[model samples]
Target chain A: MFRSRTRFRAYSLAASCLLLGVSSSALAGDAPSTIDPLNSPSWQYVQARYFDGQKLIFDDRIKVLAPTAAEDPLDVPIMVTSDGIADVEEVVVIADLNPIQKILAYQPKRASPDISFRFKVEQSTPVRAAMRTKDGVWHLGGTWLSAAGGGCTTPSGGSSGLWQGHLGEVNARIWPREDKNQRLRLRVIHPMDTGLAKGVPVFYIDQITLRDDSGAELATLQPFEPISENPVLSFDLKNVGPVHVEGHDIQGNTFTATIQP
Target chain B: MRNGVIGLATFVSVAAGAGDDYHLQPVPVGDSAQVFVGKTEGFARGNGGNIVNTGFIVGTDGVIVIDSGPSRAYGEQQRAAIEKQTALPIRQVFITHAHPDHFLGDQAYSGIAISALPKTIAAIRDHGEALSDNLYRLLGGWMLGTRLVPPDHAAQPGTVIVAGRKLRLIAAQGHTDADLMIFDEATRTLFAGDLVFFQRAPTTPNANIEQWLSTLDTIDQLDFQYLVPGHGPIVQDHAAIAQTRDYLRWLSTTLHNAATRGWDIQEVMQTPIPERFRSLSVLDQEFPRSVTHLYPDIELNVLPKQTAAKHE
Candidate 1:
């Protein structure tokens, strides 16, 4: 009886091995490692290398809201407000997975802790909103995104350099559908190539600076190679006046647009 | 030697002014064949010329093209440039792949024998019009838009066409579903389309990095002296092929490890291109994308199917 049991056990083990081999063979060519999305050193570097030892605090005082989807991921509308926390001092947003990580950082001069801005995302990734308090502690909140790929590598909109030729006609839109008194969103159509895209001899934004009717600085925006193709900046510019925004890229090309409030 | 130096000298100014952007230039690689390099538009993504070479086999009958330009505008320029070199009517056109830029110029060869991988021909026949229409909609506003032309003839693997000299088509599948590499045994030249990108970075969105590397291995073993890439300059040295092959191989191995760990695709997009593969030009611009596209394929552990499956 013992000998018979041993033989049966051995036979079943061999059968299971055979089945495993066949199943594995069937999936031989199909494997995740072949083309896994999140498995790049760059991806790891952004997470493991950049976010190390950094504190991303949670701030109930700040709230971020935007539409679920937009035509371009790079320039999505986002509104940041310090609804409860009067201690809020600054707001910074980082697209943890953008070719450029630091998306937008806003420093509020007035006590109005509320802010709005438009920023671009290359692909679907998580965006973190960190609010700094009077105590200098950073609070964090964000959303994960499945972004449109190929936009970063794909050609920009327009036929050649016509957009640059017409840079004077900068279009701007202010956001906050419900609470207009508190927040404002802005978007600019600049060919913010970030010096990485092809076709352009030099890659840089032609402009940056937002001012009031009297040419007073309301919010200042700077772009880096990490800024999405066309910058979609959302900021908290609120007042009863004419606002003019001017920007000059690294190449000394300048463009300005005025917003009537 | 002095003429070549003068030619190189003139090229530097143009290259410097163009900087990262490509300036259309002519590269004469063979006794009878010359390639017209295509520069991308100012806002477009590619920096290097989409190298489109129309070669003359110099046979008794007429001239045959290894591949045509990517668009109708490029096709006209290529044909005009060919006209300047030799007035031999373009008798046949061997398409390398079905990419809009690679075979969209078939309309230029109207009545010529438009040959490609059998599967590629079917793909072009099945989806060429829709793809062309989409491209026209997406990119047509520039440069008078693009024209669409379908293929006529289909060639399977191991197919040989012997006119004055023998030509063999090797169906290489790492770049696209059906990428054909034409071997000119007489000239020892390999007309490799997107399969090779020479100095420029290659697009690996639809590639199987492993298969691509193996195909390169197969190509290295073949006794070819010259390799004409789909994009970038002509590669006279056999070692140039290694540049592309090494990048793909290194990318596959490095990205695979990252995927095994739980890295986010978004995070990967923001990171810099791998330092190891920076030697290939366009790494900064192309690497993020290659990482994005290649990561998904590796994470999935299989190549994305050329055609999606139907489910009710």
Candidate 2:
């Protein structure tokens, strides 16, 4: 197989070289050369934000786990589990490279030891997983990447012009067998633009909140540059209740969905 | 030397932010071969042995250029250098692949026959503007120094351009679907782009390892004397191609096992690049991402929904 593949590729190379007879003069037109990054700004500070002079310490306890060291960095799998996370009431994932610093913020409703969800990393940077436990102690974990680059710069999603066409479609699927009530997964389709790119218009999601069918807020996530293009989130939901999530970006774009019980 | 962001800027940012021991050095190739901007030398050497250089082939009638530097502004700088070196006009720009750094400068060569693989042209048309837009938005004022140019002509198999010298666009898949290596029958020099990493782990996101490995075998059979990569200094030895082949062989095997074990993607992601591969450029960063890309290549039958979750 290897020998045949080699022979075939060689034949193709020779063929490609033969096709080099196009008019060289016809291919000489050059496009404009100046590029400006600030023409659009999607989010402010796009990556992580430091506050109150209390720098979030970097520890190895917090890490993002996912398949393929490289995926569309936007929706990379991330989980925050640590021995020190038991007392945490809220955690924020921030990406500092983007026009926006805050990616997603999770405010737990109950006392949970750890939190897991799938989030985006716009580029290869030090991702700060900052958690504030019930007692107000902030613990942070940091991980570095080299390849998941240009997250803020990579095109919005796999499909072109989908964000504009499906401006209001928010899809959520809870897995582990819907009745198993073991795991919950949710996805949102929004432009999630950082407003930094050129040509395309700017839009943002002002606010987004996930609630239970009984009108109780289960989780609230704020999207930012670190949140990837189309945001997919997953976590553990122990109780048997119809899950509902609502989100509204800075552009007044709103999305609401209910997971079948 | 106008506004230019070479590997140095990227390395400095990594060091100051992450506290890692990072170093970047510039390497010179040819007699006064430079990569535009302030990088007077021909190559920019990053930590872990990654190098990127820009060179032009001067023929009696015209010049055939390889990958342009980071941006259009930088490309203009490269053009200035080219003018200094050769009186012949740059009549053709042959892109070896579609990575932003490789093909973005097509705009600087006005009226030049820009050539690349068919997929490369499609990728540029598909994502070229978006890439420029993203750079502008993310880098802000810093992006002004860089420029991206979409290709004017697709270098499909059999598309030929006779400019004093015969230059062929070889169909070499693996580094990217748009991967192409420009072969000059005159010098027997192959501009392998990212397909042939000189001293680093060639990034394999859009890469087809199997096809890439096979391409290497084809390259070995070719009668080429010189080799240039998308992100490294020129290669005088054919063994560089073999080295890249060995690295991929290892990666293909290791990652295949991890995927089969149903290992957590992050666990596989966090697993450090073995000590052997660490010296390669972009290995630390590109390795994990390569894992995700490789999974799909090996587990061909598995559905995306079963193997992975949506990005959101």
- The DockQ values of the predictions, listed in order, are 0.02, 0.07
Docking class of 2: incorrect
lDDT for model 1 comes to 0.57
In candidate 1, what are the lDDT values of residues B1-312, reduced to their tens digit?
A: 224333443454354553332233556655544555543221132422254444445444566676665556556656666666666566777888877667766666777788887878887788776555434433332223345677778766674654455777798888878889887777777787778776677777567777888778888887776787776667777665788887777667768765454333433444566665566665665665576566644544421111111111
Q: Write one digit per residue (lDDT tens) for candidate 1, span A59-166.
A: 555555543333345445455556666566566666666766776555554325554444566766666567777776666656565554334454455427766545
Error of 1 at A39 (Å): 34
TM-score of 2: 0.57
lDDT of 2 by residue, A231-254 (tens): 555555545657766667765555
